[model samples]
Target: MTATQLSARALLLDMDGTLVNSDAVVERCWRRWAAAQGLDGDHVMSVVHGRQGHLSMAILLPERPVEQNLAENRAMLAAETADTEGIVPVPGAPRFMAELAGLPHALVTSADTGLARVRMAAAGLPYPELAVTAEQVGASKPDPEGFLKAAAALGVDPADCLVFEDSQAGIQAGLAAGMRVVGVGPRAAAHRPTVQVADLTSVRVTRDADGGLLVAL
Candidate 1:
């Protein structure tokens, strides 16, 4: 696989779709929820990825009350975490992440700490030291709050951050946060990322003696 070289001071990654493949559980849960609400599952699926559960719910059922959306989001989170069937890391995710160990990076996701742990473990991936979960951000993806907060926690400039995202909302958030975005899959292409890669498998990064990384795209 060929990749263009790039430089960045920090990496900000999305958890579920980008690093881990929890599609089976995610879609199943959402599909059930859509059925319960009489909403179109296809539309719900289109809007749900990369956005917080509550945000997805609100988008899919705009006429519903906010409190109801919150309550349902909580239930969905619990249900999704309770089942790990078919949950696994995305292709090349572990290897790419292993290479990024000891580097300045953050796991920025719509899932909170507990769900993040369950999914990451199910996928056999490492937990990031610096993470910005849904609980920490006031707003969800397409808002840029998560990515901005993660970059701040790492003490890195937002412009110096490279974000790996698999959702349109996540890509928008990264771009709005003033970071370079790498689209991680086919879905991400619609967001028009700085670069698009099939998966994390081909990603390579090397540390220079000067303490900077030369990312091999």
Candidate 2:
């Protein structure tokens, strides 16, 4: 595919599959929970990415009470945080982050503050100073709240913000927030982001003459 250039005043980023490959820990904790719940681990995994643990649990076990999901989610978060054996920065993530120095960007992730900190630290990536974590949003991805909040916090119009995401849910949230999305990694290819890239290595960010971001994907 031909590379595409997109213009934006700010960038909103997702955490898990986008900047950090925490699948090993996520799968380990979630699969264990799935088994205890008598649900198929594979199917649970499908709905878990890009969502908060409680939200994912609610989706997989619709009949479960919100309180129950919330309780279980807390436990799941602890387990995932404790096990970072396979966590690593996505390819080119460190370089990509360095290029964003002094640029307008904020992390918008489903992981709460603690989990976000743990994962980013484990992956040896710099955490953005501005972040909208699960605790900051009333709704998860596939709902525009998180992205919209990030754009607002950065004082940029939603249309002028670009979102970097790797899951279907995150892509949908970005679009729903009226922002363009640069899907990263294999999973995002099928989500119909504004444009798709294999990883951060395929992305380049530069300042345009107007002082806005010029993102080449």
| Candidate topping lDDT | 2
Task: Please count the clashing residue pairs in each candidate, in the order shown.
Answer: 0, 0
Model 1 Cα displacement at 13 (Å)? 0.6
Off by over 4 Å in 1: none
TM for candidate 1 is 0.97
lDDT string for model 2 (99-209, tens) is 998999999999999999999999999999899999998989989999999899999999999999999999999999999999999999998998888889878899999
Q: Could you give candidate 1's per-residue lDDT for residues 62-147 as a string of tens digits?
A: 89899999999999999998989999899999898899899999999999899999999999999988889988989999999999
TM-score of 2: 0.98
- Give candidate 2's whole-model lDDT: 0.92
TM-score of each: 0.97, 0.98
**lDDT of candidate 2 at residue 101, scale 0 to 100:** 89
lDDT of all predictions = 0.91, 0.92
